[model samples]
Target: MTRLVGYTRQLAPELGPAADVEALTTAGAVRVFVDDETADPRRRPALTDCLAFLQPGDVLVVPSAVHLSHAVTHFATTVTALETRGVAFRSLTEPAFCTGDEHAVDPAQVLAAVEGLRRRLVSLRTRAGMASAAAAGKRPGRPTVMTPEKVAMAVELRNLDRPITHIARVLGVSANSVQRALAPLPRHPDSTS
Candidate 1:
């Protein structure tokens, strides 16, 4: 009999017991290896052990597709290795990989998977950009805090050997605020300030 393994980045508070219960109730017909408290299956040592535990034609089931990384090369390599071993994949929440014939264990499925991965990468980039903007004291989806005049003054003050504290005090802001405001100014880039 083939096995079904579920991989997750740490079991959910609400779903942890339920997942174990469901796996245990599988009646010993399909050995279910439930790896708990993992970051990513790719990084988990248990995943290597689980892969070794798998026989040809075994299946790995995940709850959602996004649990897998959004890196196309990474995802593709993983899927290819599993396919080479005749180990199938299933996402319970996404019937495409679980039930759809065209999507189930087919090379064409890579396109859809790649597209999904691309979308995920885009979203991750967007979130990272927003976070960096916030750290720089700029609000996301808003006009920049440093106007042209502000940047010019920042460069002028910085060149004048004025300490960041003094500049910020004069500018009516924090030292960090001044640093951030002046960060965009060319730092000797192309010999320009």
Candidate 2:
């Protein structure tokens, strides 16, 4: 019997949604291992488990190619190891390809298609949200603690040779805040005091 293992990090939300579906569709057993470990690459518990359970002809399904490696070198090493074992892999949401066989679908191609579609959808949604915000007259970015008029007044006071400590006291804000607000503009000559 062909065994299909769907593995994903526990923290990855994408894995959770598709896990049940993969198990239902596949005839073989499915094993999920949380790959969250802060240790030497060889000492990772999940990696150890995957190696132990893996056999020739087993198909490992992951959420994304990136989930397999923390870095390019690590990914390459992982691919090599899996290849040596004759274990194949397929990604659910990323470049959809099955490993093995002469005419296998290129994983990179699938990944690129998935990524491009995702980016376009996200961009459209972001633009729509920004437009709605603008229509509502809600200022974008973080909420400002001080109004622009107050900021202008603060700048004017700083130009009149008031000490930062004194300006902060008048503005009812911290000296640190005064410094932050004026960071982009040139400092007033009178501010030396």
Candidate 3:
């Protein structure tokens, strides 16, 4: 008998069983692995065990395709491994991912999947690059207009009893910006006397 091994996971976006066990059992899952903790391969023991337990010719039935893996890269890698191992995939929700020679999925859905993967990969690379730049003491976003020179000029103009609006007009900044830059300066020692 071909084993219909089932797997389920739920961690975020409201906790509870994310996959339907009764549906998997009805779908012919002799053994079902339930992981309530994490999708991280090293952390989730049940998922590791489930992957190890699966054999050739066995069908891995999942309630949804999301239960397969967490990240987009990991999801694709997992699917590729399953395909290489001759283990067919069966999704109760998304049937388009099935290895069976079934004539059902829209061509647009396939294109969307490829596009989504490409986008995710690009996003990951961008994030990594940004982080690398940050670690090297480089800020990623728009440079701030509040330079030390501007703050110093505001302080000197304020000491000379210049109007905040006049100082702001000279600095090409808002009066509020001038006020903010001057707010944190040390108070005059004689003013407290």
Candidate 4:
């Protein structure tokens, strides 16, 4: 007989929907491995326990594909490892990709979906990190070396038809910096007068 095993990353039971647990329970999942208090997958003790407890006919059930992994390569590797151990994978939210079921879905399609989800998750995490940094008054990327005084001097020299190399030498700044500052500023409609 195939044993049902559940897994989750959240610590608190309230954090996960009751419906998800109910679904797993209905699917005959008797054991659950939860990685509470750790965001790092490398430090998940409960997951280790689940892995050690897994039998050849056991099926690992998860609430969603993201719950299994947010990384495409990791997800694929984990699934393949389980398959090699004679264990199956099932996601309540993604029933079509359940290996425990008799329905045969293309492995390539599942990999494509995993890759798409991984890309979207990575993009969202990057955007959130940038927004958080901005909120903390931190600027992203390299700091500008050009000062307003230097920019003004470059602009004046350029307006006087000075050669870019000559302007750069006089200002003691790079030719690239001089050229960038000398670029024409956009005129506002109100400043047309």
Q: Of the candidates shown, which would achieve the greatest TM-score relative to the real structure?
A: 4
Write the number of the candidate with greater TM-score, choosing between 3 and 4.
4
Residue 151 in model 1: shift from native, Å? Answer: 11
Better of 2 and 3 by TM-score: 3
**Where does candidate 4 stray beyond 4 Å?**
11-19, 127-193
Error of 2 at 22 (Å): 7.5
Candidate 4: 10-residue stretch with minimal lDDT = 184-193
lDDT per residue (tens digit) for residues 1-193 in model 4: 8899998765232455465667777877997776753356446677778878898999999877766674767777888899899999988767655785585888787777666667755864576567768889999777766689887776666666678899899989788877777566542334321
RMSD of each: 11.2, 12.2, 6.9, 7.0
TM agreement with the true structure for every prediction: 0.48, 0.48, 0.54, 0.59
Ranking by TM-score: 4, 3, 2, 1
Which residue ranges in model 3 land beyond 4 Å of their true spot? Answer: 38-42, 103-107, 113-193
Pairs with backbone N, CA or C atoms under 3 Å apart (clashes), candidate 1 = none
In candidate 1, position 74 carries an lDDT of: 63
Task: Give the per-residue Cα lDDT of candidate 4 at 75.
Answer: 73
Candidate 1 residue runs with Cα over 4 Å from true position: 10-42, 98-110, 125-193
